[model samples]
Target: MKRIRMIIAAAFLLIVAPLVFSCDTTEKKVPYFIINVKLDQLTYPVSSTNKLYAVFFVNFNWTTPWLNLSSSRLQIITPPLNIGDFPLFFIVFYDADNSGTLNSGDIFQGWDGVIVSGNNLTPIIVPETEMMLLNVDLDNNGIVP
Candidate 1:
């Protein structure tokens, strides 16, 4: 009788194991924010080759920035980004660079400090605005002429 009970228990476990360990088959969709930046009014510098790029300042003044993309003459549309664990915010930099270094530029339009989350999203709009520029001479010696 003891041997018969053990066999029965083993067979029952084998039948129930797969059901207990089964996982959901559905894939979850991630939420994202839509950022719209209009750049029709920007003034191209004299030396500018008219090259423009768009910068994403992830998480509100984060010291490290995300990848910047080449911008059209009119606007930039961002891909969906998953929300971070901490406070969520974003800024867009409409970048105009004449110095060849895409980062160092003579004109910048900064759209700063936007809290992005929740279902009722308002398309974050960044209108054209003249922003402070950083002129960087990466290879120039410390001596100033």
Candidate 2:
């Protein structure tokens, strides 16, 4: 009976060893985009209450979360993206009423057909990383839509 129990234990170890040891150790590579916005402070001064916000869109189908803009030079980092080229549209707005959406008193700036590719997600140079630089002056260059 002891010999039979030893054989059963050996068989159990043989069956479970591979399953316990072999695990998927590969890390997932998540792609992200970055945008550096340069605000023109002379025309539209940065105030405490009235804040700036940015949103990215693709054909009005997909939109990213609202990124708060604080300083004259602001960097926006996107979430993970799938592997493909996307024609992205960017909007930087001044929230006068502190509401998230666009309203009557709000001023905005937008750029269309900004193509970004996901293939070169990981770049070598940090300063020369894949990013878009936007110069925004809400008072002078604000768009209605």
List where candidate 2 sits over 4 angstroms from the true fold: 1-43, 60-75, 80-83, 112-129, 137-139, 143-145
For 1-145, candidate 2 gives per-residue lDDT tens digits of 9999999999999999999889768654545655555555665454655556666554443345334434223545556544344444556666666665656666765643222222111221223234434444444444433
Evaluate model 1: give its lDDT.
Answer: 0.40
Question: CA lDDT of 106 in candidate 1?
Answer: 32
lDDT of 1 by residue, 7-98 (tens): 99999999998887886675443334333443345243222355444455444443345656554433444454443233333334433444
Off by over 4 Å in 1: 1-22, 30-34, 40-52, 57-59, 79-89, 99-145
**Best TM-score among the predictions, by candidate number:** 2
Every model: Cα RMSD to truth: 12.4, 8.7
